[model samples]
Target chain A: MGMLIIIDQPPYGTWAGREALDMAFALAAFDQPTSLLFTGAGVNWLRKAQDTADIEQKSLEKNLAAAPIFGIEAILADRTACQRYNLNSEAMIDGVQLTNASADLLGQYSQTAFAG
Target chain B: MNQLHTLHILNKTPDHPRFSECLGTLGPDDAVALTENGVLGLVASKALGLVQTYALESDLSARGLSDDNLEAATIDYSELVNLTLQAERVISW
Candidate 1:
């Protein structure tokens, strides 16, 4: 893989996670291989049924649903983090693959970056 | 602008790992400029005195934090910009 962008922060609190998502899509637009690993509080991004209207923000759930369409390779959530956030397959959006979020997982990519 | 070798601009809250990660990399010539939620670090620890720390005055006031009794010097946006310009290496964490 060309690069792995690790998103460790939860959505909406800051622009970091959203900026990272945009970076991933920008890379995909150029046909660069990009994967995203949602670990720590970032696993909240994959949880389904986010209602962002009250927050006056775009729904990241809706945005993430378009990842595959953008040619972004994979959406990996840390298994432990998922459990901590109580996000089971049923509670999360479709197409998210769970992994250990280990150092070995990071080694698969030649380059790795933490999302802002 | 201070004569610093490196300037670290941090915006993460104290609870975030990047906060300490930024602190861990500080060299003798390096200084840290805290902005956004990073200004909260001043309330989180006194050990932050180890580094030459500067907190964004605007952010601190917005968060209802008073830097008068805090360990960090309060700076404005222009000073933060100058810090980035002055340092040979700059990192935003």
Candidate 2:
């Protein structure tokens, strides 16, 4: 069964990104199929320009990059959310897919994890 | 077997209340995990009595809180990992 991850936290300034990465890593480590869906403020984590060095927070882009490498087959971000937040597909990390909000994608998952 | 619903709440601000509302949608046997800024809600022991609750110990400690301050049950990362396996469906909001 597929596991759905809803990330509502942004990349920097909080533990949300790290927690999401941890969960993703765990799912990948176990060879479980996992999908990530970015919603609410969490869509900002996909912004390509994130630089946490000035704030001393660890960069999560590496984790984002590893998603595809780890066999996570799908990465989705809310299209309306991205537009509302002034984000573009260009802003996201490579390999992330953009999709409008729909229940079909979510309904397929047997489990969903909300990582804020 | 019944599909378990596990809700992981990460909201911290009491004023912005959706987690509590989401609780109403929970089945009686569902599990709730308080992590990140959501630890604040873990202190309302009277409120969480009816539900199966868990707080991330590392998060609590990072916030300078101990088990003494938590109203719900607290568990380690391993426990949280175990819960994920035990639960048939894990939902986070």
Candidate 3:
């Protein structure tokens, strides 16, 4: 009912998707309805077994696990994008709903912003 | 002016996967606006001739690209927002 934040970049390579996640968090914090859509390479952010301990970065999996608690509306992943990356529902962090990031999906939101 | 279907605001470099993905989603009535590193698409893609494309003038200038020889038009910041206003939807890739 508010805005859709699209993440099309893969995690860890650049901070774009991560920053987009921050924006989503901030939006949630302010009680602004926000949802996240992971498309293209951004689908990688949904993978469940990311071990970033060596990379010394915050785990997106862990971060996303806390998304709903922060009041985020939805955690959406593009079906095609997830299929291309070979991520099934079991391999993804829980609570992710698969949907096409089509014009219809975007039309539901008042704003759609891309991250990186 | 006719209402455009979607305005693709791309800022990725040509080599980025999203760059190709963005181009692939273009419809006949869609437009593309290249900004930031996406301006490099003006050099990388000679195949955008069919689409109504625009590059941010400052971004193109910053990259040493002149729209005079390019297939797309160049617009200023205000015109960029106007282009967004003119379109039915926008996808910032």
| Pairs that collide, model 3 | none
Fnat, model by model in order, equals: 0.00, 0.00, 0.00
Worst 10 residues of 1 chain A by lDDT: A47-56
lDDT of each: 0.80, 0.67, 0.80
Model 2 alpha-carbon drift over 4 Å, by segment: B1-93
Q: How much is the lDDT of residue A34 in candidate 3? A: 95
The digit string of per-residue lDDT tens for model 3 on A20-79 reads 988999999999999999987677677666655534577677887888999999999999
- RMSD vs true structure, all candidates: 10.6, 14.5, 14.2
Q: How close is candidate 1 to the true structure, as a TM-score?
A: 0.57
Q: lDDT tens digits, residues B1-93, model 3? A: 557999999988665889889988999999999886676566556656678999877655433344237778988889999989989999999
- Rank the candidate models, highest DockQ first: 1, 2, 3
Clash pairs, model 1 backbone: none
Report iRMS (Å) of candidate 2: 11.1
Docking class of 3: incorrect
DockQ of 1: 0.03
In angstroms, the error of model 2 at A113 is 1.4
Per-model TM-score of chain A alone?
A: 0.97, 0.90, 0.96
Could you tell me how far off, in angstroms, the CA of residue A47 lies in candidate 1 after the best superposition?
0.6
A20-58, model 1: which lDDT tens digit per residue?
Answer: 999999999999999999987688678666655433578
